[model samples]
Target: MNHLGSHKLNNVLGQILLAKRMGKTRVIAETGAGQHGVATAASAAKFGMKTYALFSENDQVAPVYSISAGLAYPGVGPEHAFFKDSGRVEYVAATDDEAVDALLLLTRKEGILPAIESSHAIAEAVKRAPQLSKDNIIIVNVSGRGDKDVAAIADYLEKRNTKNQE
Candidate 1:
């Protein structure tokens, strides 16, 4: 796959198109940083699958990008948009914790793991989801690893401590 900034979404779109040719009817995924969300929605649209995405609170991109891309697909609609756009399928949760609760409910009702962008959140969400004995199926986008997040976390914590002491 091409790096985040590259237009490597073509690879994903190819896969979705192939799946559609093979008779697959739906596609689902999760997003964190918005890159994967945009890509997945585009792919689902390409394949004409009923696409659904689940995004985390940390997502920094507009959901409309993903939603519109999905809606542009033959069978998909804004309702399945996970990131942005206004429709029944798109659901915005207050936090990752809340998204997890919704994912758990979805797993119970749908028997599938909803897509999410964070690898860290996926396992926990899957475990919390009903009937998910194993969390291996949850695909985490892993946009940035712990090494990348450490400096940011430390900075935030230090600022938080300073604010608390003030």
Candidate 2:
């Protein structure tokens, strides 16, 4: 099978070997650069599994609880910070409610359950969609899939509804 170019061994192997030799098992990377923790994920994936689970049941990483193990982090890289500093980009934060709603909308309307991470972008897109002209386009970059998040989504909605009813 062909490998993804992003999974280029050079980005990870040497570092992984060194981590292993040191008996260390965790790695952290940039967060919020994509406004979706993708910067963190790119580095995490490069180093391989660091979650509580030993083996992933599918292609993507296993489901994680909120505060999202690898994604809910602080700070941005210099390049991302520079863009923000220069006024080239406007970073937005989407709440879990917005993201979960967006995820359900995509699942029911478009038959796509995007990753919890990518849902942040979709949530922002939904908020901006009505404000834009009909000709305007909003493209959400879905960097990951949501197969692992189905259960998590269900749990989140259940807890939210229950909490709201209280």
Candidate 3:
């Protein structure tokens, strides 16, 4: 399937566009893996908007993801933080194991290998899908492909297998 390498870029661009439409001169955001920050900076530059990206110095989940699937990030986008605070978006943390499970499920079912970040979103959707009406549609942003995570996932699964056998 053809997909954006960093799907989150679309959101960042959309926010920038909205800010521009509203006559804002500056765009500020925070990012974890630098993807959103990079995307925001690029979009802002395109529109001649001043941009700032505040990255987190410490984030608990970043290290684990870095080791497990190489999807670690120090922080999320500031807009995401704002949405969480305003009740427009709910933030959920998925463990490496859960994300791996989601990755496997998606790969097996849809034949698509999703990035670790995208796996987190997929895992969240799996958790919420059962509660929603059948008519409801859930859209997940698959920010990137999992080609880079193949080795990491293999290592994770090998360790898991060893642990299960022991």
Best by lDDT: 3
TM-score (all chains, Cα) for each model:
0.32, 0.59, 0.59
Deviation (Å) of 153 in candidate 3: 0.4
Q: List model 3 lDDT by residue over 77-128, tens digit each.
A: 4455446555897767788788889999999999999987799889999999
TM-score of candidate 2 versus the correct structure, residues matched by position: 0.59
The local distance difference test score of each candidate is: 0.48, 0.62, 0.74
C-alpha root-mean-square deviation, candidate 1: 12.5
User: In model 1, where is the ten-residue run with the lowest total lDDT?
Assistant: 65-74
Q: Which tens-of-lDDT digit does each residue in 36-70 have in candidate 2?
A: 23333444465563512122344344333342334
Encode model 1's per-residue lDDT on 1-166: one tens digit a residue: 5444636376557657665775666665554345655776766765567766665455554434221121222222222432233343333223433433444455577565544324225445455556665544555353433444335445555775798799
CA deviation > 4 Å runs, candidate 2: 1-67
Ranking by TM-score: 2, 3, 1
Clashes, model 2: 0
